[model samples]
Each structure stands twice: as C-alpha cells, then as structure tokens.
Target: MECPNKEKNLNRCNCSYPSCSRKGLCCECLHYHLRNRQLPACCFPDDVEKTYDRSFEKFAELVMKGKI
Candidate 1:
C-alpha cells in the first residue's frame, strides 16, 4: 500500500500550496482534489500552481484557453 510515484514526485513537485493532505499517494491525491472540484497538483506547471488557485473552474478556464 505504498505510493512510490507520489512519494518520489514530492522531491521535485512544485506544489507548494499549504494544507495539501496528499503529499504522497497519487490515488488519494486525485481523489482529494476531484472531491473538492479541483485538479491535482500534477495537472499544472510550476508557475501556474504557484498561484495557489486549485479550483476546477480555473483549470477549465485554462484548458479552454489552451493555456494548460
């Protein structure tokens, strides 16, 4: 039950938002994000995620604008 992928990504991941409960465990990470109507950290690049705006609406806006 070890999430090696997520754990490993932690070292290089640019997700600096506070209150992130899924520092590891990709599955749980996705679940947590989606449950809140937002995309996971991995979906965005460093600069974008740095905005600390993890919302599904924002992600969709970026997608529609082809900025993501």
Candidate 2:
C-alpha cells in the first residue's frame, strides 16, 4: 500500500514477528490483528509482545495490572 510514514512508523513499531508484512503499516497491522480478535504488538511491552499473545484478554489483564 506504500505507506508514506512507513519508515517513521517502523522506528516506533515494536512488533517482534519476524516475517510480518504489515510491520510498518499501522493501519494494515491494526486491521489484521483486530480481525483476529487481537491488538497489534505495538500495544504491548516488548517483553509481552515477544510472547505473541496479543489477545484482547491479555491486553485487559495487563491493563488491570497496570502493566500496559
């Protein structure tokens, strides 16, 4: 989709998924994750993101624990 802000977004994206096609494309990444009932890795801490558990439940848990 040729995101104009891709390089800039990449600097802040913390996704650890090695082969993510939407790595720097925030819109695509968010839509993709939401369709799967998950949040993109950018919503999580690096430690948590690396676990590949981007579920809504996980995000809630982290929020409740003040970990997000």
As a whole number from 0 to 100, the lDDT of residue 34 in candidate 2 is: 100
| Tens-digit lDDT string for candidate 1 (26-48) | 68877888888888777886777
lDDT of each: 0.77, 0.96
lDDT of 2 at 26: 96
Candidate 1 residues lying further than 4 Å off, grouped into runs, are none
For candidate 1, list the clashing residue pairs, or say none.
Answer: none
C-alpha TM-scores of all predictions = 0.72, 0.97
Give the runs in model 2 whose Cα sits over 4 Å from its true position: none
Q: Best TM-score goes to which candidate? A: 2
lDDT value, candidate 1, whole model = 0.77
> Tens digit of lDDT per residue, candidate 2, span 1-37?
5999999999999999889999899999999999999
